[model samples]
Target: MNELFDQFDEFEDDLWGPIADDAMEPVADLSVGSAYQAPVEWNGIFTSPSEENNAYLPDVEPMDQTDLSSIQSLDSGELQPENMAESFFIEYPVFDPENADLEQIVGDPAQDMENWHMQSTQSSCALVSQEFILDKVLGRDVTEEELTSVATDAGWYTPGGGTPMNEMGRILEHFECQVDYDINCTMDDLSAKLEQGESILVALDSDEIWNTGADLDDILSEYFGMPGQDANHAVQVIGIDYSDQGSPKVILNDPGSPDGSGVMIPADKFMDAWEDSNHFMVSSGASQVSDQMIGNYYDRYGTWYYDDGTPERYNWDTGYY
Candidate 1:
């Protein structure tokens, strides 16, 4: 039995050795690009606990205008509220520097402006496109060898390694998915295109509408048709499958998970999920079409919600158009 096992081991190594060596040998055509930038350190402004007292509204008044005897009695209980007269206690919100109301303060406004600057400068840096991912699936007949060559030439990945979904955001550098807020096409049109085999970019403003009525699980099931996808997660639509299921299923490159993995979703509900997201896109070719298809209404903009009975208008330039 030992002799037979030893023979099998020798056969296995002999079979795979040349293949491994061939893969490792560098070709004249292969070129490796620089790595995507390492993540930047966060510099978001944070208000210290020490700043709490700065928020206080003092009740003191102008010093010289007050009566001398009243001032002398200030330290004792004999100075009743009525006797001292009422001093106004003004309250103001601590605001970001861009929105600070320093001019409203009675004294030299420089001190208030300085505090606002400090807080605003401490704000943390974040990946601008951290909300979406991008991937290009290899079509049939493209071997691992051919695909690697193309991906390298296109400046997409490392030679011997894989690029992460989150890292794509950093490499793209300033991930403005669209030029502005508007989407290019109608939901129906986008649906038809996605039904075809085109790669699409779906942007999600997780801070807004989609996160409203649903928990992470509900939202994931609704969007990807996978029940466990979380609210904190953002992914791109790479492929859609409809071979066996009643509805089409979307293939997504989910970044939050390990391996920057993929997931499939039921196809029919895809548009419903896209609309639930505040802003998104489906790139038909090398060019982006949000400007041509959906219009710029959502161009770099967000959405708002109110009570069900609140009056609303369908402004074409804003969304309905």
Candidate 2:
């Protein structure tokens, strides 16, 4: 995790850009609304030489400007820990266009204690970020030998699953997520892997993920300073993709991916690419994981430690203390 943040620090300027006005509020100020947009003027007239006549043409007026105060101007620098707002927010896309549904992918599961939110989203809180999720799901934090051992263990592949792989898959399915398993397998293999009430990990591509900007590529290039293909920095991949292929895409699910709507990485590049960020993982318990694996989960992450030598907070967001 330190290594991952070090990567963040190394490319801090490129990813987030320089911190514009140092403000600490994790949540963007929603008071004023998005940038002030001018209102459209109806019945405006324009003289067109092409018309070859002095005619009163209906001029299309610009729209009224919105209150810019509510909407904060985002940049790469905003990814910094110190500058992160008090409450992060992200708008999830409609994964199932056929279904025409849209919702926020990441949030406090405590709000919904029943349903998949309780078992899947709630239990894997540590996987809020793409990097952490990938590390744990793929066992990236573990070495190649460890991964191989776990993959070939056969214990991970049996029915009525109890292995971490099976358990993680069930957790991911709540979000309709998929990931490249330690050992390559097809749809059938994945389906068979599930237990009576198990799920599959969602493998998200960076392009499909949503960001502050209308285009996700722009956001990745600007704020995070990481390229769209940088899979090493696995943030939580969110959003629903409904097409011939179901892709759960999202912004890098870092501590800064607003409201926990994390970013996505291509399954093919998800593992090798994000390694460029020097990622790591931290896990605990039978059915509970903090949103942050170990790095920056929230504002006070990495600041205080517990008497039992446990960390009081995690820095999944990478917000400065």
Candidate 3:
């Protein structure tokens, strides 16, 4: 992981371009009743234009500009950690289409548990993230204790260790799940996968998702300055929200959140924080093998087996199969 961070540090001098001078100006206030809205225009933030007649686009107006003060503070480098907001809120519109089949794909958000103040289980975010996907997306009843045991046996937990992206893949394989670790994937790639009824696990800096009372600008600035600062944390991407103008917002299930409910973030903000880790993510789903059968095999044999019924025998000493 350190090597990965080093490589990312050397890849660029600036992760994003300078913030436009007029970036903070609110474009429209589309707020209706008591519900929040998406901002109409973004000055410096850039998002991919929607594909022609994309059927997944939500039927709602663009978001209204809430408080963009943090953005300005980030641009000027004068933001302090003590002045950060308690939370960044964005109300995501429901995904409703006339076609019943399509609507089924965009169903409800996954259930998740919070890891807000639990420091002893710092490295367990990946396990928690995976558990939510299995339970909610794949219809499995997985308890946190069961996942912790699996992670411990897989050598994914240490006193102060973090789960590597590759380890996450191996862990999923135990349940007969296939995972693709892509460090070069874009938000569009994630959206496409969600449309196909797949769930995504993304690794991001912790500050980007939690409200730590620290200026987000300062936190991000410091993160870029020292790439080795252990900024890896995992979350699941379960849904997408499209603005009236067709821009997409990412909805995440942050295990680290207090409530662990769906958290909405603008695509650009999420991408910027994601870029620090090379946009690392694990796109996973049920594998060709039977999940139940494979899980039972792991429980009995203490290791995963290949599709051909060969044991993935791990040599405890060398820590490799």
Candidate 4:
């Protein structure tokens, strides 16, 4: 038996000796343009996927925010909300540095986002996202372990495997929040819902969204420039930062990051990563837990109880737009 196993091992090494590396090299470096811009320390939390999955990335059209003529404004000829184009998504405004309120965020980072939870496993982004949302909006003290057990029992998630892209809605519904899924969602759609103080969860490319740095754009210029497929990660959308008028950022509570609370990202880069999933989103009503001891929202057990109600409204004054 030992001699047979040894022979098999020798055959395996000879068959793939040139391809296999004892050190295991990264076949390609996606950040060719700005290797100096993105710090190496962030690579652990912000993964740089191998180029093998490049086939999955799609060509993303440029996002145009220049035309705001259709947007509602304080004007006589302003378009009514109902009259707006379905394609006329409410634009996410760029941050205006001169605004005193915008400058306040430099001191109060917690205004847009306050809390977060990191995933225990690399594949637990979905579950960890669930846990973080439930904890913040519902005040639910549920643990990630508990969420894993419940999600696994329902077959919504595999033990160590990633939750299916379509299964996120089921898990949210199971947790008592109303979920609306969009396979072809856009940033404008997000802006519209967020303005109403709703909770949003998005699945995008962790590497692309994380980029070289949290705020830096991808160094790769090609469509399949970066390695790996999109939608490999999920995060809770808290708000959009329009303080940097030229570079409006998407504020998110990314569960995959070590300290992901209130992570801000450039909108264009966000669109690039999001295009990977066709901008898949699961938008839901925020927790409605009131002062009353019990409320309408149910727990994981499905018992009728009380809890959080509608989420925080998008505040334009504080970069929450």
Per-model C-alpha lDDT, please? 0.31, 0.31, 0.55, 0.58
Q: How do the residues 168-284 of candidate 2 rate in per-residue lDDT, one tens digit apiece?
A: 343232212443343443323322332111222333222223233444445433443334553321233332222224443322333333344322333334433333433222222
RMSD (CA, Å), candidate 2 to true, equals 23.2
Please report, as a residue range, the 10-residue window in candidate 3 with the lowest summed lDDT.
37-46
- Positional deviation of 91 in candidate 3, in angstroms? 11
> What digit string (tens of lDDT, one per residue) describes model 4 on residues 1-321?
699898988875554435223223333222322211212122132233333332232322222224444566455322322332232211223233355355423222353344465666656778877766666556645577656655665668765467988987665676557778997877678877777666788888876754443323544552322455444678877777666678777877777654466766778878887887788998877654432433455455644433432212223224332
Best by lDDT: 4
Please, what are the lDDT tens digits per residue for candidate 1 over residues 156-193? Answer: 53432343333333322221332222354454444454
Model 3 misplacement above 4 A:
1-120, 211-213, 216-230, 244-247, 289-321
Q: What would you estimate as the lDDT of candidate 2?
A: 0.31
Q: Could you give the candidate ranking by TM-score, starting with the highest?
A: 3, 4, 1, 2
- Superposition error at 200 for model 2 (Å): 6.1
**Per-prediction tally of clashes:** 24, 85, 8, 17
- How far in Å is the alpha carbon of 293 misplaced in model 2? 20
lDDT of 3 at 48: 25
Error of 2 at 153 (Å): 26
